[model samples]
Target: MDAVVIGAGPNGLVAANALADAGWDVLVLEAQDTIGGAVRSAEVIAPGYVTDLFSAFYPLAAASPVIRDLHLEEHGLVWRHAPSVVGHAFPDGRAAVLHRTVEDTAAGLDADHPGDGDAWVELHRQWTAVRGPLLDALFTPFPPVRAMLSVLRTQRAAGLLDLTRLGLTPVRRLGSENFGGDGGPALLAGNAMHSDLPPDGAGSGFFGWLLCMLGQDVGFPVPEGGAGVLADSLRRRAEARGAQFRTSSPVTSVTVRGGRAVGVEIAGGGSVRARRAVVADVVAPALYGDLLPRDSLPAGLLRDLDRFEWDGGTIKVNWALDAPVPWRAPGLAGAGTVHLGVDNDGLLEAAKDIALGRVPEHPFLLFGQMTTADPSRSPAGTESAWAYTHVPSGLEWQPDALARHVDRMRTSVEEVAPGFADHLVGEHVQSPALLEEWDANLVGGAINGGTSGLHQQLVLRPTPGLGRPETPIEGLFLASASAHPGGGVHGACGWNAARAALATQRTGRRLRRALVGTAWERVLRDPRSPR
Candidate 1:
C-alpha cells in the first residue's frame, strides 16, 4: 500500500479517500467489526427507534470545506434539517429558539423581548461577514495563510479586533457584553457547553458563536436514515476511488526498522507495510504511548505526553420515547437540538460542580430530538431522544455512581419538560467507560478529542511543535482528533495529516526540514511553552 490509515473514523476515512483521489493506494484498518467510530447509529434501545450511539447532530460536518468538496450527497448521504436548529429551555415559561435563518431566529426572540431581535441580527451579520474566512482559517492547517488573507480582505481593524476578542473572551463574558436578555447568552453558553468547556472557559465563545451561527446558516442536520449512513457514504466514496478497508484489524504498533515508520504491526502477529507513509487516526496517547516504540520518541515528547490533559467525561442517555417531548415552553419541540440551561449563574454552577469532582445537582443537558430532524429515526409519531452531560474526567466511575448521575440528568430534564419521564418506553445509558469500550478514540469520554479550551488548541494541540501531523519519524504522521482542529465529525485532522504526508512525497527531506523550522518558530519560540 502507498499509505496505511489506522482507525476508520471520519478523519481516517476522509484522509484515505483524499489519498486515493491523489492516486495513492490507501488501506483503512478499523478495530471494530464495523466502520464509523463515533458516527455509527444503531437500535440500542428498541427495534424501531434508531439511536446515534455516539455523535448525532453534525453542523460542523456540513460546514467542512473538504466534506463539501467530497459531495457525499451524490454518495447517498441525505442531510435532514429541523424547522429550528436549537432551542434553549429555561425555568421561565418560555424558551429561546434559534431557527434556520438569523431573521427567523431573532424573530423567535423578538416576540418575547424587545430589541433582542436586533441584537441577534447584528451579531449574526458580523458573523456572516467573517464567517467564510473564519471557517477557512478554522478548518485549514495552521499558519492558515489563505484563511488569514481572507479575514484581512473581509474586515478592517475593528472587525478583526472583534474576532480576536471573540477568540479570547469567555462565552459568559461575550454574552453579557452583547445581549441584555438571557436568550442570546443562554444560546451561546449552551452551545459552548457542548464540549466539556465551562461557560467562562476561554475559547468557548468561539465554539458557541460558531455553532449557533452555523446552526442558523446550515441547520443542525442529521443523515436521513442514520449517522451510520454518513460513514457508509464516506466509505463508498473512498472505495469508489480504490481505497481498501480492513475491519477488526487493530494496529498493535508502528513498525520502525530505521527512524522512519515503515508500516504497522497488527494485533495477533500480523502486519501491513505502508510503502510510503503511516497515518494514525487514533488519540495522541494511543499513538505515542501504546503504538509507537518508546525508544522512538524523544524524552521531551514523553514528558509532554505525561502532562497531556484530557477533556471531561460524558454521560449520555438514549430514550425510545412514546412521543415528542412536551416541553413546557412548547416551542422547544420543533428544534432538533435542545439545551436545558440553569440561566447564566446556574450554568456556571453546574460547570463548577463538575470541575470540583462532584456530580452536579442541576446538570446542564443537551437534548436531541432525532425524529424532528429525520422521522425515519423512529416509528410513526414516536421519537428517539437522547441527552448528554459531562463530569470531571478524574471522577471514579462505578455503576452506582453512574446511576446517581443518570438520576441527576433525568431530574434536570423533568424539571423543564414536566412529564418528560412518562414518554420513555425504553432507555439506554452509556457511561464514560461504556463509551470508551465502544471506541478507543473516545478516551475517557472526552468527545472533542480532548479539551476544547485554548491552551490545548492550535499550535499547542496534541503537543507543541507537532500540530501539523509530520512527526520526528520521516514517514509517520498523526491524524487523530487529538491533532490540530480537534474533534467533531469534521475530517480536517486526517486531511491535514494526509496533506502533510503528500508534501513529503513532493519535497521529501527538504519539506521535512521546512516543517521542522516552521514548528520551531511557531512552537519552540513561545517563551511560555515548556521545553
Candidate 2:
C-alpha cells in the first residue's frame, strides 16, 4: 500500500482520501464493522426512525473547507437547515430561540431585554470581520508563526489583539463582559456547553463565539436521511479516488523498521506494508502506549502523555416518539435543538455536579429532534429525539445505573417540554462504557478525543511537538481529534497530516529526525524488544 490508515473514522478517511487524491494508493482499516467512527447513524430504536448514534448537528461540517472542497453534496449529501437555530428553555416557561438571521435573533432579545439587540449586532459584526481568516488559520497546516502572520495581516492590529483576547478568555468571563443582559449571556454559555469544558474553563470562549456565529451564519443542519449520509458521501468520494476501506479489521500495532513506520499488524495477525506512510486516527494515548513500543517513544513525549487528561464521558439516550415533544414554552416547539435548564446558574450547578463525580438530578441536556430538523428521519407524524449529558471522568458506568440516569434526564426534559416522556414509543440508552466498547478512540467516553482545555489546545495538543501530526517515528502521523484544531467533524487535522506526509515523501527526510534518532537508540538498548 502507498499509505495505510489505521482507523476508518472521518479523520482517517479524510487523510486517506487526500493521499489518494495526490495519486497515492491508500488503504483504511477500521475496528468496527462499519465506517464513520463517531459519525455513525442508525435505526436503533424503531424501524424507519433513524437516529444519529453520536454527532447529529453539523455546523462545523458546513463550514469546513475540506468537506466543501470535496463536494460531498454531489454524492447525496443534502442538508436541511432548521428555522430556529437553537432554543434554551428556562424554568419559567420562557425560551430564548436563536434565529437564522442576526437581526431576527437580536429583535427577539430586544423584546426580553432592552439594549441587548445593539450588543448582539456589534458582536456579530466583529465576528464577521475575522471569521474567514480565523477559520483559515485553524484549518490550514501552515506553521503557527506563518498562520499568525496571516491572521495579523487579514485582521488589522486592533482586530488581531481582540481575537487574541477572545481566544484566551473563558466563556463565562466573555459572556459577562460582552452581553450585559441575562438572556445574552445564557445563550453564549449554552453553546459553549457543547464541549465537555465548563463555561469558566479557559479556551471555552472561542467555542461560544464559534458555535453562536456558525448558527447565525448557517443554521445547524442535519443531513437528509441521517448523519450517516455525510459519512457515506465521504466514503464514496474516497472509493472513487482508489482508496480502499476494510471494516472489522482492528490494527494491533503500527510496525516500525529502522526508526520508520513501514506497515501495520491487524488484530487477527494480518499485516499490510505501507510503501510511503502510516497515518493513525486513533486517540493519542492509545496510539502511543498500545500501538507503538514504549522504548520507541521519546521520554519527554511519554511524560506529556502521562499528564494529558481525557474529557468527561457522556451518556446518550435515543427515543422513537409517537409525537413531537409538547413544550411548555410555545416558542421552543419550533427548535431543532433545545437546551433544558433553569438558567445559567442552573447549568453551572449541573456542570459542577458532573465534575465532582455525581450525576445531577437536573443535568444540562442537549436535546435533538431529528424528525423536526429533517422529516426523512422518521415515519409520517412520528418523531426521533435524542439527548446526551456529560458525566464525571472515569465514573463507573454500570448499565443499571445509567438506565436510572436516563430516566432522570428524560424527566428533566419533561420539565421544559411537558409530556415528553409520554410520547416515547421506544428508547435506547448508551452508557459511557458502551461508547468505549463501540469505539476505543472514545476512551472513557471522551467523544471529542481529549479535553478541550486551554492547556491542551493548539501547539500544546496531545503534546507540543506532536500537535502538527508528525511523530518521532518517520512516516507516522497523528490524524485524529487529538491533533491541533482539535475535535469536531472537520477534516483539518487529517488534511494537515496528509499534506505533511506528502511533503516528507517529496523531501525524503522526516521532520523530527532528532526525536527519531533518540527513540531508535532506546529501542536498540532494550534487550526484551521483539525482533
* Alpha-carbon RMSD of each model: 2.4, 2.9
**lDDT of model 2, residue 10:** 84
Q: Each model's C-alpha lDDT?
A: 0.87, 0.84
Q: Candidates' TM-scores?
A: 0.96, 0.95
lDDT of model 2 at position 247: 96
In model 1, what are the clashing residue pairs, if there are any? none
Error of 2 at 111 (Å): 0.7
CA deviation > 4 Å runs, candidate 1: 517-531
Off by over 4 Å in 2: 510-531
Cα deviation at 273, candidate 2, in Å, is 0.3
Whole-model lDDT, model 2:
0.84
